[model samples]
Target: MTFSDVVEAVKSLSTDEKIEIQLLLQQYLREERREEIYQNFRAAQAELENGSLKFSSNIDELRKLIQE
Candidate 1:
């Protein structure tokens, strides 16, 4: 089966079933986003430990770092 087939099957679902699927998809998306944020946090920690990460409070300094 392909994406179109899955879409067609969803189209055939009753209103309640469609609502349930939408809720489930929203939950799945939230979990995926949470995992992505966790991964990014871990990567940033590693970068900090390796002494490659930069931090600044001044806007001019931040702009120079970003340009590099």
Candidate 2:
């Protein structure tokens, strides 16, 4: 079914069912975010290994890098 159909179906759920669905959706979102973070860390690690990642020691250095 389409998103609209899913929305309508969820709207017809009982209060307890809605709460359970909300909790499940929240958990799914959290897991998605964690996976995204893990993927980013892996990319950063690869960049570091290839000597492509830049590190700044202080605010001035960070600003200089951003300006470039």
lDDT of 2 by residue, 1-68 (tens): 99999999999999999999999999999999999999999999999999988997899999988898
Each prediction's RMSD over C-alphas, in Å, is 1.0, 1.5
Question: 39, model 1: CA deviation in Å?
Answer: 0.4
TM-score of each: 0.91, 0.86
**Candidate models: Cα lDDT each:** 0.99, 0.97
Candidate 2 wrong stretches, greater than 4 Å: 58-60
Candidate 1's residue-wise lDDT over 1-65, tens digit each? 99999999999999999999999999999999999999999999998999989999999999999
Error of 1 at 12 (Å): 0.2
Stretch of 10 with least lDDT, candidate 2: 56-65
